[model samples]
Target: MGEVDPAFVQELEHRPKQGIIEAEGLPIIDLSILSSSDATPDHSQALEGLVKQVGNACRDWGFFQVINHRVSMEKREKIFNASGKFFAQPLEEKNKIRRDEKRVLGYYDAEHTKNVRDCVKKLT
Candidate 1:
């Protein structure tokens, strides 16, 4: 988008870009093992490994993708469709629920990130 704000450009110039070079990719954690309730010894060990994977993913990346989470594709699609509709609204309409000092659980138009990019996100 047009040139980034000069202030943001300056900030980016001073920060290290090491994280990008160090990152492999977003971590992917399987939820299938955690969902089982089997009492076998192997199951317990597997569960522990799963937990460790989750902890590492959180501590290092702050987030991770989960597979075999058991949610139906239809339900996921519904959520995606709804989100699409919500974000597609005009800025004026979205601003009706804009987050402010008094509330921290609504739409945020421009969230600043360490990389000098603006991210639009909603919190609920």
Candidate 2:
């Protein structure tokens, strides 16, 4: 089939659902129990507390981050730099190796299509 008009896609009708109800605020978890000179003599107590907090957050907000993970600072920096570089590229360059076609490699639009593939090819 030929290219589909984006406007048409956007206008396609769909079933309606009940509106979401806004909630008050997130529940607070006490993390102070995780730190001390002689607290429990092992990380088990701290870990248990964290697990409970994570479970609550997951149920209430659907997401959260762990602060004490052992990933190196250097690796985190590299990830941030790489993500920024990818987003900063010209639109044409990004579409050249679209993600859908390459599957495991190449850049593509957020929806995964190869449309404007020009800028990056010219750079290299």
TM-score of each: 0.62, 0.39
For candidate 1, give the lDDT of residue 70: 96
How many angstroms is residue 64 displaced in model 2 relative to the true structure, after the best TM-score fit? 0.6
> Which candidate leads the pack in lDDT?
1
**For model 2, how does the per-residue alpha-carbon lDDT over 1-124 read when each residue is reduced to its tens digit?**
9985553342223311224223535445555544545545466767687788889787655555455455688998898778778778998877776777437677745442133222322211
Candidate 2 versus truth, CA RMSD in Å, comes to 10.6
Model 2 earns a TM-score of 0.39
The local distance difference test score of each candidate is 0.79, 0.57
CA shift of 52, model 1, Å: 2.7
Q: What is the lDDT of residue 72 in candidate 2?
A: 81
For every model shown, the clashing-pair count is 0, 1
User: Where in model 1 is the C-alpha error above 4 Å?
Assistant: 1-26, 39-48, 118-124
lDDT of 1 by residue, 64-111 (tens): 889999999899889988988998999999999999999888998677
The global Cα lDDT (0 to 1) of model 2 is 0.57
Question: Which residues of candidate 2, in runs, are more than 4 Å off?
Answer: 1-59, 101-124
Error of 2 at 26 (Å): 6.8
